[model samples]
Target: MPRKGMRSLFFSPKVSTSTDSSTSSSISYFPSPSRFGFSPSKPSFSESVMNRTLEMAEPIIMKWNPETTTFAKVTSLFYDNRKEAIVFIKWVKNLQKAMQLFITGNSSSEKLVRAQNLMQIAMKRLQKEFYQILSMNRAHLDPESVSTRSSSTSFLSSISDYGEEDDDEDTRIVNESITEVEDASSIAMADLKLIADCMISCGYAKECLKIYTIIRKSIVDEGIYKLGVEKFSASQVHKMDWNALELRINHWLNAVRTAVKTLFNGERILSDHVFASSDSIRESCFTVITKEGAIILFGFPENVAKNSKKSPEKVFRILDMYTGISNHWPEIDSIFSFDSTTNIKSQALTSLVRLGEYVRTALNAFESEIQKDSSKLHVAGAEIHILTTDVMNYLSILSDYSNILSDILADSPPPANNSVTESYFGFTDSDDSPAPPITRKIAWLILVLLCKLDAKARYYKDVSFSYLFLANNLQYVVEKVRTSNLKYLLGDEWLSKHDSKVQQFATNYERLGWSHVTNTLPEDPTAVRTPEQVKEIFKKFNSSFDQAYRKQSVCVVLDSKLRDAIKVRLARKIFRGYQKFYNAHGVAMQRDRNSAAVVRFAPEDVGHRLSDLFFGTVDSGSGSHSSFDPSSSHSRRP
Candidate 1:
């Protein structure tokens, strides 16, 4: 879900002098920052100078304001005032772009705030104009007829036999007109919705987020619909149960329906020919994800030995998610790549699983090491951040995908009518309704939200993303040694010893781990080996090796003569180390002894002495870092 980088990085050079016949003015976009002398090192962001520029531009904007001008003042005044609304909106948008261009590299937060205020004022005015037009179809009705209709309605022949009801009637007409205006404004929301959609479609992600925020706040605060509050909340949601999830889905559908009828009641009937439908591309995506999740859940490696357990159970769930996406939302597919079409629906669904999977694999060794030190777990935000960041990559990619999808959609044919295409699972602004109001915004809003959300998620789960995350200064030192990058740092003198130690460590661990890898190797040498076949062989080896060791231990225990003959290894070592230390230091040393420390020839001789440790009395080299379990810690002693 990365940006395809199809458009030029800077927008100025790409700006065409040729005017778009459809638009009010020729508003060509900047192609790349090179045209403006901006680049990575020199970003197009200026706080002080930007503010001054914006301040300077505000008066120019005010000067350009055409709010007071009537339809007659418009160049093509004979056109519907609604059509004029489009032109005026375009002009306002041009002013906004001009302000953005001026503010680049020169804007401060305060200046940005001012810019928002100006944009909001423009939106509010457009909202007002749209409202007025919709009310009583004032665009078509002249002042004289409007006046006559108003007077006749006011003079009710049956009402006042004594005097004129002019004042009351006029007041009623005004109130009715205002109410009509207000109601029509909601129906016309599509025009505004289109603006928001265009803002997002045009790469103004932050502004899109901000405008969506405003829409949510306006509607939610107004308490127009319970479902709307839920839809807005649901669309951006991170986690929720199935019931709540379904509730959110239902709420959105209902809100779209209700808003279409109540907020924008219109004389026009919805056309059957209109192809407003969610595409197979989206629903198929959900299906793929679902199968991916199922596959991961079905086949993930399980923790057979708590003694050697690596990550927590929760991580498996996460891994399953990664698997799900890997299978469903593969990086490259024949028909399409998930590189496109990352909308709110995709982000919410994809991120959760992506995060879960990355966390499962990111810190493989640490989870196993922690089994011996289970008593305490102090989490830090950095750990969660690592997991979040891993998953966030996908979401980020998904976002990029959305942008691509938008571009694709721009080129796509309209939706086709089909009885099968009855439902949309994710989100829709309005299934069948008139348009609404207009607003504009810039791109920083989404970035800020992403930064904050990332900050919060990381703060809570401060686990190391990997061993590398915890290495501090030592990691670079180790990496240099490993990759032969720091021959100078480690020095040539230690190379022999370093190689020897690493080799020796590898050999011994290999021996210990071989039982895990080779036990299930096909005894029939002719057997073919697929990847899955090899994997199963390894798991079988681990399982069989475990069984073999248990059988050997059982046989020794059952033979009484050998069992009695066996000398206690722990008793000798403890006494030797204890006596040596005590005699040398001239102090009595209390050698810590659990049942495992004292060898037992009989199974019943020493049973369940240290119940808390994984290795029983066996101490993992990590010492305090491990969780204590009684049965597993056999490494500690006799």
Candidate 2:
């Protein structure tokens, strides 16, 4: 007979007896009951055989009870006898059929609740069995502890004159203990996998997830718990079925992704609250998920794609916060009691160096993450170029802070009895001594900013704008370094390189800005000249100069020294050409009374006007040559 409580167990025949003789003759061809068990009677062999067949099939019908049947019971039976391979295989088949029927008969919610309960129970039972196995194996697993207890007990027994000893018996006991531990460990590992499978078969994905979470947590906790008590290998933790764990992790990753989406809200700028919340979530993932598990479950391609899709605005916002914090580093020093020391100045400088180093490290990490897989970043359309430029801008701002810090250090008094020169300048220090911490940090900041600048320049659609932007930032950085103590740390090589870069920018600017004005100057003074031609040259010069001044004046040059140098260069180019033209032709121009009015600028007048070019106060009519004779040698441009 089929097992009790099995609803779908046996197949019953669908044949009916009939009163007609022909029907009975056809039915006789069916298997007789005598074949099953009953002996044929002398009066009627066929009737005896039929009775026995009916009796044999009745038990199958009586045993099936749908109301009393359950998948839980079937699973329990299978696990109880799971150590016997043949019995375990048969029970597993029975449980599978029972689950199918249960699923088909119930609603989805009901099925889920039932499956969840069954899985939870199975996991609990499996855990109990595992502990039991571990207990059985403890003798070999912790032989030292076992032997110590045995020694104490035997010592007491020996004092009482009741101790017994045999070398062969002790050896046998040790070998048997080792064999038992091996068997128990194998059985526990196998049972762990079986329980995991049952959870999967029951369609309890959440329950499976919980079980795996527990396993991972337990592994971590076990190590912590036994840190000094015993040594544990990572392989022991990894002994759980990886394939099953991976499957569950994949499902959990989708949930995590969904949660992350809701947290970000598809927004470019993340608020402080959002940032805090996301950080918490990230910490949770790191806690629960192993690196290998994350790699397999999250996949590098998808993670890279997701990260690349993040808005550049978010990156900028983070950088801005970092800059703001760095700017108030002095305040942080006071709040953190760094100013309490006798060497507060050095402490402040050290703190500033640390802040700069942190910013550089963070920027590098950001760049590395974004550009890890360039192809994916590109495919996802990340604004890597913009991010790079923004990072450079942040560093450029920090370089200004470095200047302020350097000034503070320089103004600070030397220690008692120490020479101001020696202490402030480190003059007495060895030539091979390492650079001051602040100087090295500032050097690193400059290098990283320049590197990012080079990278960002490549993606500019307008190469001229790229050059202009780079020139603006690089000039600012170099000037800051040169004017401050950072110059000593960066050395003369970096200074020369940067100075050349500035000159290149100036050359580009001159070619683009002054070409038309220079082209209008006449090549020869003795050549026959028309007043119309000379007057037209002056007109063109005024127009071009005004246009160039208006455009280039708005361009940023933060350093006063650099700005003054630029103005000097502009004055030289404009006045040198104007002075020559005036010298060669001023006498001829004086031949007409209207020529004085026509000549818009004398050389000295141009020199005076050039001072205001970058100062943004140049007036269009400020350089009029009224009340001045261009023919006087004293009137030549300074």
Candidate 3:
């Protein structure tokens, strides 16, 4: 007779009875149990029955040694004979109970030592099985596959559907094969969880976690490498040229997305599922696998921001990196939420801060470069300056990243100087309709350039060319703003204000470009004159108009619209003004015999010559000189 506790302690399998070998061992251990008890109905009978139970379970426990038959060759233990595996786990528990009973009774015998040895054998077999399952099913148990376990059917169906689009036999077979692999992946996941649960329950979790984390960590590291992520130091990044750095940035942009969305996220999910038995293990395993690689991955941007040489053009790439992190911040936070992995989160955030700082530094340097451009090299034809072209092109490309710049420049104040703020050009700098930082920042940069252009225009000796210089450069700036993403950022109000300035510059150029010609004629065109007076007036007009045409012909106005408008204004003022005076004087001059020498050009010839004025000297065949210095002194402000 057995005690109730002893009867309850015996290992039982719902699916199958004990094997024949286990039965024979039970018979062999029957007499040994009675030797421990004084009578059949003894109070210590439960302890005796437990001792017998361990001995009977020995054959099943040691049946599959890791050294002889590996789990890779055989089917999964839980899948092949779950009942036997369950019985084996029960035997492990019973062995612990038997060891405790022997120690309590102060009877450490051969049975106790045997139970201890059998326990070690069971653990070794389970550890081997765990490692084999993980290793053999590496591809199937990949983090991506494990992550999709919850949606395996839909994922497989999508694969099948994609393959069906080709309508080929090979595709069909490949789809079926993928479906089978997905099925196997599901089984593999369940099997990993089962083995994990068993080893952890038996106090062998260290061995299990060791194997799991090592394999999984290598997979994650490989994933990062394959994505083109590398451990880059600040110095290494600093030494690279902009073009080379730009390529690395692009690679990081692609790699970071896949790393966050798939690699770390999948690892997080897989770790949590595999170690569902323990929260600490889940977090530990995930942290071990992803922390180092994630920090390096995120730290690349920080290194670039900190170490790379600052340039206005380099800001766009930094913004791209910032956007990559910003776009996936939610996933990154969720995946790396564990306290153990908080450094990864902190590193990512630090990269954002560093990138923002770098962008601002580069922008300030750009403004400084514009301000420091002291080259006295006057641009030929008073056309768009190189500074204007480079600055506007930089700003236009910068405008494309306005959304990110807005965030980075949120706290950055506009230029404080009153000259660039609202004076001179009448930039719309009202406090009431406050612009965003990026808009104000861009406006300030333009104003700085405008101020710089004002200085550059002074290099021209002729005040008319100075005004033309301002008009040409300003027109180019306005066009850049209108065509690019800057159009939306600067707004129509900003464009309108600048357009008026351009018109003002044009008016000044029209007034000054041919001032000599206009001022030569009388105010009242129909005034009477003697033949001598009329011929003298005609001689002065011819001299002034010829000088003006020769000088203005070589000057360039690149914009067709601006060029036409200037020509029209000059035609109205100079052509019409001279025509009235010429009409008044021609009859008197024609009566004189010296009319042909005096009245050298008619009004129609003057009008036709105005057409050739603004097309540059190169086009007009007016000598190779693009610009000339006039002796007449005029204020540079024009």
Candidate 4:
């Protein structure tokens, strides 16, 4: 009896063998009507049906092998003539169909395993063959090799015998080769994608990823190797180890940075059309190369907390990398357009402002991270402070290139009305003031640095020292800015504001710094008391002065002019008051010749002593009052 649906393959009537032992035991054979002629004369019905069924089943049985020999044959064909990618692809499809049928039709584990092994071999072979074809096509499309091939061909043709038929045949072959090369190169990407898809379908996902990686790497390799070749050459690309490849990538990035820097510096002039075209090409190429890296980095599954908690060191490294490139972005973007519609200086200013915003964001992130880690406050704060300082330094360097800030700083104050000017200057007009983009940026940077410094100052246990530190740093910043071209950009208003702040600091210092010394002085020096009071006052003054001087001597005052001004102000305030007290009480103290009435310091001696107070050199005995002239030329009091 035939299995269900088996009878349809042959021209035969259904044979029912049942109940009768004789009929069930008997077997019959017959010629298949589609295969051989059936005898019309007295042929047995059972025999003819049996023979037809047998003939039909023979081919089906032969096709049931689990190994699927067709795949192997297709693989061989692909290897032999990989250029016929269309034909190879068709065969691959057939092999896939055979694989599906074999998996579904077979019941034995051994046969299924055999089918699996065969498919693996086929896929492996296909990959190998695909790679070879791709490589060959890439070589042919390579600009350098193309030129070499063309030149060689031309030379050969020029020297060849003038046999028209042979020459024509050779030309036809060359044309055909050229066409094939073009076709291959054009289809390479599509073919790669197809191959990856096929691998994925075959449950070779790992292989698919590798294929994508290879494609990305090839692009990067080509870009690096062909950078200055003029004629692009795939032949020059060699397989690099991971370290070497990383080095190359860094080299390329640095080159890009250099190019961008030059563009910003306005060193290179390019037409709008050419610049746009080249820029597009560069962007596209970089996108292709970086895409795979981005995918690989982000594709993996990771814990949210773990992924979010990047180490400060790593974050800083990443920031440094970005900052290194971003530092040049302003100049790059500042490049003047060939069309002359955009002002280069204005563009530079915009770029600088944008860069400043980015840096601000980074700083905010850094501070936020530090806030989360309280134990490392000092360490992190110091690092952040350094980073901010570096940003300021970098901005200073940038300012040198574009005097946009300087120009803005030098902006003339708006002209006053004739009445106002005549009233103020006793004239209708005054000299034009000079007139600043990064001016704002630098100002912002300074503000940020101050904030950071203030934050760091909180780490110190001593509030007075912290105040002193702030005062010293703030004074230094103001002095540096004032002395540089930055003074113009910062403007008179800014200078005034900072100067006022410095005065405030000095006031704070007086309250905090001079408390001990001021306590020793009598508020009303004109009123005289006993000689005991006079002696006590001078003794207390000398002791307090020595103590205060020792403490303040090591204190930093970076600006020399600021230091001199501070010293002179201290001298006049202390000495003038001390001299008043002595003149009022000295006569009375002379009347009492007690040991307490013996003055340790004359008025001139006191003046001399005040000079040495700040520097911790108060000598109670040495009478060197000549060098301590309080009325000597000095910086005007703040």
Candidate 5:
């Protein structure tokens, strides 16, 4: 048989005459110069073992001429050794080529079968090498390291150079000292690719891919578990108390970033690199490894949005989840770009959509809460309303997340029937374009609060106090917007417009609050009056001025600047008229004891009394002989 001829040639080394079992067992085949039909020659001691080693490995490709064989002869060394593994891979490639040669040349069917058997043996060895390299080099061939290692030009260039060089040269590169951490990683990756290339080439791709997906899938699953991402049904999430749910959302916030940036990303790179030779395998491997974890990771926010109680407070956490997904969209798109993994991307996008929906719903509920506020309790002293404080605080915090809200509110159209909202938001005949949706939404919420405050202002008995209440509450809203991120969302133009409204309300309050006192003086204070007219005018002025001062001194303006401004305006209106009247009549009235009693206050006293107004203090000064002292009132905060 042809096998007997090959076996006899391997053990018949002429120089190995000593038949000691140990010495004979050490002999290996090495190809000689004359073996390919050039010239027959005997081997020396040094060359004898090498010749025998070559002859032993030659049986697999015996029909093919050795002179033209492109690969190194397969050695008896174990496939586990790095140098021998490199040589083994070379021999597998030669076996493939020899099988092709026999099939093409119409060689003996028995030889073809033998070559097929040899190919299966080579594939089995490669399968073992592939699994061992993946298992033993977990740290060195980690997905993160392997992903980065695939991009190393030095390692890739070394591999390219290995393709052109002899077996010994390739082995030398593999056997070199691994100086860097990635050096060993690159070597492991190279080994994996080599075995994968051989196995897949021999039609054992299913077996190759099965081993890969099983190991890598477990790693990806464990990674998600380590990151604290767990799959939750809608009911499960809905049943969780807000505090527990909040903590889970916080964990998801951190986990999503790491999963997208490092875990799934690293797996993607590793899968693509390991199966670089096959597009289908690359996609299939990455999809299987990452899809399940990614779907669960991204689906969490959707579950929270859909099933959790629609409390207004929960919207903030939903927005936070929306932000987590929106921030990492680029990596999600790139890592899960495969068609097979489109569901992962869809799941993430669904989370964003659902979160946006929750925000819109919560905002509607917030608006309804504002509308339904039925408490008619008057704010004593016309101070800022509780509704004003609550709403402004809410809007101010909402404005802090304007960028996220912008996206969420992008598709929300403004109320179509309300011309007031349209005009307020700058939709005009000249430019009919709508404001940004977030701008409209935020501005609209504020408009609703103002409408509610306007209704509340009507609860005051005096029209003057009503105006003062509006001024106070509106000023609070303006100040809140000015000091917080809301200022940026509602532009300076909106602020300037609202600021003018506050001043107008303040003006209305001052005029109405003190008009009766100013009206008691003559239209022209210089007009000469008889003693009777002067006495009657003084009598009327005393009653009205005392009443106005007493009433207004108890009312409050909380802001110091607005308080001072209102006081200054009141002084100008009252002092200009009363000072003229007192100068016109005081000379005559002072001469009579009865008339001087009626002329209770001089111009200086009037000015001093006006200064004392708006401190929210009860006036203790009797109108009789008390000079208006600046320091008489308590300095308590209003």
Candidate 6:
């Protein structure tokens, strides 16, 4: 059963006269010794064999070795003596394969293609012969023999190992003749000077400058564009194409640096001033890129910079915002004044909560010290309440003086550069699309807070190991105040007007300052509501605030007037005070588990103004909260 082309490469010639001995032998295809080594294990799985070989060899093959003088030299030799090399290579392949089959001792049981490699050498085939060879050396091709051959022969040494891993590691020879890369393009300063002089002589000074810019930008990106690839007919300059001008600065690196500084300094300037100033620079420096040759850094903001005319987009985008904030710092100063003595009987849910959490976390860090100090232990809840009240009041009234900001946030939402701006700025058409107004933003915060409280009150009843920490999550409370859903309760048209003065002010608050808002009345202030109406409004804010207190791990404050103000009318004309949240998110409104609380935490004696803080329950009918009952009959004290 010997194949016709068997032993083609190894045997010198084929026997002219075919005999019975050869026929009885059934093709003894004993192969010659192979260069490429192979040693099969005992009847191993073919899949594993192929898998292991491929896994081991693929890595070696993928590695590049361009600096191999040996390979380059061998290429010529291979092409010249192609026949001899091919025959030798086949002989080596066959011998090792046979050796592997012999060692594995797996007698051939399946039909296979002939192992004969070269048609040019011997004119015989090889399927049966290969089987005979496998049978003949099954015992001799053992692990021991294979190991001896592997150790004795320097088989791989002849092949040049000049890749990154092999050449650089084993040998310290740096051959100059074997170059891997071509030389780079070089344009000297002297050449540039000569070119400039020549261009001036030719009455093309501007063209020369334009050419210089093209080279500068392109060189930065592709590194001189490989000297050999192109003809520098006009010197890498005249062929320029650039993006259109937009006052958008994506200086992420600088912004990141500013952020890091703020993080370490804990400064408001870093959060507010940094972004405002950078954005201002970007917007205010708008110049028509008239000539597209060289970028004239000096002539930016063609209209605005050189003269008095300004881009409305610039005002909306940067100038109005930053300059207004910068110049009107006193307004914010007056509005943000905190009253350390006053307790916010009515709270700004999210704001109050965060301060409480911060205090709690601070105390928890040194719980041993806190517990030991009798005064600290006694005043812990009191301090939290006072701080919570202060924070709530401040945040609640923020809407009053920041109407312009509220409008900016609601009507025209814009991208914020820093923390302070990000927190306050709403996405708007002036910025992106009109942002939900600041009041609405606060409303949304309140709604979310209400949802969270509702969820905690409604769903998380069973106290377990996981539920234990639910008692002290002040951050969650702050979130409610920060993200109150005011839009749903207050008509979107009223709360989030695109052309509202509030948004315009907000977009320009930083530049104009807080005084502009504190002194001015809302163009359309919410109509006063009767205490008898909107009872639901008071309830929601109350529940959400209660949740805030609960989050602080302190006893909840169930105020009378505060609870009774919840109703429908107030929901329609959402106020800037604490009642706004109470109406929208506590009971009738949808609740989200992760929603922020309406109020924030701050200690008593912290200065805050009703004019400064908004988004709370206001009893127009009763005029004051002193007349309210704590439990049943909801009445506001005059």
Q: Which candidate ranks first by lDDT, i.e. highest?
A: 3
Against the true structure, candidate 5 has what lDDT?
0.73
- Cα deviation at 76, candidate 4, in Å, is 44
Candidate 2 per-residue lDDT over residues 555-602, each given as its tens digit: 444445555666666666677877888887766777789776667667
Give the per-residue lDDT of model 3 (tens digit) for 1-638. Answer: 24454655453423323667766565542354566766655336435655676767677776765555565246555556644654665556556656666656656666667777787888887776777777888898776776666554333322211211222543454445445654777656655675677677667889989999898899999998888889987778889888888888888999998898778878887777678779998999899989888988999999999888888777888889999998899999999999999899999999999999999999999999999997664555787888899899999999988889988999986556645556543456666655688988888789899999999898888888899999999999999999999898888877898899899999998887777778887788767456777777788888888887777777777776787788777777778887898777776676778675788777877776776666566332322323222332222111
**TM values, all candidates:** 0.17, 0.31, 0.78, 0.38, 0.77, 0.17
lDDT of each residue in 270-387, candidate 4, tens digit only: 1111112234332332343333322221111111111222322233322333343346545444433333313433433443343333334444554554344323232211122343
Residue 31, model 1: lDDT of 41
What is each predicted model's overall lDDT from 0 to 1?
0.31, 0.42, 0.75, 0.45, 0.73, 0.27
**Candidate 5: 10-residue stretch with minimal lDDT:** 71-80
Question: Best to worst by lDDT, what's the order?
Answer: 3, 5, 4, 2, 1, 6
For TM-score, the strongest prediction is 3
The Cα RMSD of model 3 versus the native structure comes to 9.2
lDDT of 6 by residue, 323-386 (tens): 2233333423322222420121112122223222332233233333222322211122211222
Tens digits of per-residue lDDT, candidate 1, 43-142, equal 2433333444455445633432456445322422212443333334443454465455656554655666777666665554543433333333422222
TM-score of 6: 0.17
The true-structure Cα RMSD of candidate 1 reads 32.0
- Report the C-alpha lDDT of model 5 over 1-638, residue by residue, as the tens digit: 14454345335544553689777555545455455977646543323333444343445333222233433223222333556556666666645544554465445565566567666666765665677777777787666675555456244434422433467788677656233323667766666676676677667888999888888888889888888889998779979999999989988988988888878888887776677778898899889888888888999999999998787777787888898899999989998888999899999999899899999999999999998898665455687778888888888888888999999988886666557765565332123665678888888888888888888888878888889989988999989989999888877877888888899999999888888887888888667458888888888988998888877766777676677788777767777777788878787789888778998888877877776565456554732222223434332211
Residue 615, candidate 3: how far off, in angstroms? 2.2
Candidate 3: misplaced stretches above 4 Å? 1-38, 42-60, 68-116, 147-182, 233-247, 413-434, 520-538, 577-599, 602-604, 618-638
* Candidate 2 residue spans exceeding 4 A from truth: 1-363, 366-448, 451-469, 483-485, 590-597, 622-638
Ranked by lDDT, the better of candidates 3 and 5 is 3
- Give the higher-lDDT candidate: 5 or 6: 5
The lDDT of model 6 is 0.27
Q: How does candidate 2 fare on TM-score?
A: 0.31
